[model samples]
Target: MKESEKHISHFDIVVIGGGASGMMAAGTAAARGKRVCIVEKNNELGKKLKITGGGRCNITNATYDIHALLSMYGKAHKFLYTPFSLFGVNDTFRFFEERGLPLVVEAGNRAFPHTHNAHDVFRVLEKYCIDNGVVVMLDAPVERMVMCRTKARIDAIETSKGSITARAYIFATGGASHPETGSTGDAFHWLKDMGHTVTPPSPNIVPLRTAESWVHTLSGVSVDSMKITFLVDGVKKFHKTGKILFTHFGLSGPLILNSAHTIADMLHEGVVTASVDVVPHLAHGDLDKHIQEIFSEHKNKNFKNVAEYIAPHGMAVSLMMMPGMPLSDTKVHSITKEERKHIVHTLKDMRCTITGLMGMDKAVVSDGGVPLGDIDLKTMRSRLVDNLYITGDLLHINRPSGGYSLQLCWTTGWIAGSCAE
Candidate 1:
């Protein structure tokens, strides 16, 4: 049978996954006069994008230097130089702003809509796709790819609904993170079967569950300007100072999530421990002196009464219950010098045993997919499959939360769409 007769559906470009990259790729390709069709497993497009940045949709970071921006991905930094240079963060701002969506930079160079609604970001992409004549197949899961061995290319994609044929294909099905959004690592298996070197996917930007149950009581309380350090086998691997929230499971927020990638690896090796410096800016000796002053001033008051001034609301109550701390009924002046030191140590280095990471269902972005060496960074096209392209979390790039992940989608999707023949 002829190539055209064997395939069920035909298009100039077929994008699997109606996510940030898939939608962007389809829209960009269709805008350039290519017949485009997007196959998405989810009923709605940009489901994960809609909930990002706490529903504000952190659009992109405002880092102008390509090197500085790439540095956020660590080892994956080198592979991103070409893609960022082609469609950097600045280009992303221009791309969205030009389409009538102006972005506002929030704390830490994170960009979001002025209205602070993630749905608006999705709306723009939806409009762009519709305006450019891109066909969207919602609720369609791609089951496998039909490779043309003679041409050494991906000739067609088989989905739960049916098969789709295209001259070129882009896979932006995302990773195993946020399973409710339909990202379940299905694309990884399909690509692995096609002879691509696939990295085992794991939860990256996810919350860490601790062995201590006291952390649950501290849920909803966030520590600002705090420092969190991840130590692997007694060696500190990574540390970052920012804000983190106490969760029912353990720790979360910006700092904890960013450190989750390294923590997950440590947990796999054996056991990982995290130390939180609530008062990172204060020196240990200085904090000790300060506490002495507080003790002297509140000598007549109960130990618990003095806690309110020294710690943030609710923290004092939790701290008093920590190991070796005397009851709240004890007089502040009655506390011993050694006890004071213990209190200071507890405040400075609140230790938590990291048992494991939350599942992909809670991860912001998953780590694992097509290995970096398997794709051409310049065009984001697969080195093994001539007509295939990869983008977004589907690539094995570890990036901190902000707008880095979405910016990646924009950069890779744009390059892949433009380069697709």
Candidate 2:
């Protein structure tokens, strides 16, 4: 038969969305003697996965304790106990290592393939699927479903090419983010139509925008150690300390992306702002003393030079331009005590008002999906649809950007594959 004329029918299991979780699930099921097939809308698998962490693919964290790993999932931590315990971080290491793809743990306990190529990670999984006898159909977008008489279960799925039937179906279609990678949230609408309560999808772990011109001036400046406080109407809501990268629009990096949620929420009521402490480890008094010493050491030098030594040159320049700030050209020896205090304040409390969040195209991971109650956390099977399993970003588990998202994909995909009859 011609490739387009091929109609795969009556498989033991059928998996949708050939991304990380979908590929993992299909490969896992086929490994255990199940006749499995993966239906991917895109021509290639793992498009988004290939680009994660800029193509390095942080597979999981070195945090081996199940509790610690689960904690990264936040409120959904409890829901993941079963899947994670089944195939947690260590097991992930073993899974990849056994496949001859070793992982290395970098700073922050993030584990990436030793090759540091995300395509390498996907290559292994793709080979696993191919070697295990799993059928892969690319460009087969699921159009709609064929539900059973009860209207409470999915009997089969009708795709763009043809209809597929299976004893079990795994929907690992990911989420709405990165639609360019083919995760356009087809399952969300499909699941919601089937009575599942899907939480509204929003861009998560995305960069923030700012109205402050100073932020734009410091566009490529990055502070290795800094604290960011999210405030609404000048009242602090929350804060975190980490590295931050100033962008033309606003902020990016671990410090800003993780806090974007609080900023998103605070946008409703007041002016959302971010107050950055470039030297969070240093106290006000200590910083002043330190600045005083630096000024004395470079008494005749331009303040700009000293400021650049204290912080990034761009930030120093921007700080000097802030309202009522002394000129960057001022000599350090001529700096007044009040001017010293102003410098300290600017160093400790660089402020920017958030304008908005970047759109879904830039989201590292989306914040919403099918709520947990709709599926059994123990098995990743639908409570409403008995023969159906869901995994990955399809679940409404919000987590910070790290290896946590991919780990969730690994665990849930493996479990869904293992448990699917």
Q: Each candidate's TM vs. the true structure?
A: 0.93, 0.93
Q: How many clashes (backbone atoms < 3 Å, residues ≥3 apart in a chain or on different chains) does model 1 have?
A: 0
Candidate 1 global TM-score: 0.93
The parts of candidate 2 lying over 4 Å away from their true place are 1-8, 300-302, 331-333
User: Per-residue lDDT tens digits of candidate 1, residues 322-358?
Assistant: 7998688999989999999999898888778888989
Pairs of residues at least 3 apart in sequence or in different chains that clash in candidate 1? none
lDDT of 2 by residue, 1-421 (tens): 4634645588999999999999999999999999999999999999999999888998888898888878888788878888787888888999999999999999989899999999999999999999999999999999888899965667888888888889999998999888899999899888988889989899998999989888888899887888888888988888888888888888899878887776788999898888888888889999999888888889999877787766654577787777767677888888899988987888888888888999999898888998887888778899988889999999999788779899989999999988999
lDDT of 2 at 385: 85
In angstroms, what RMSD does candidate 2 have relative to the true structure? 2.5
Which residue pairs come into collision in candidate 2?
Answer: none
The CA lDDT at 262 in model 1 is 75
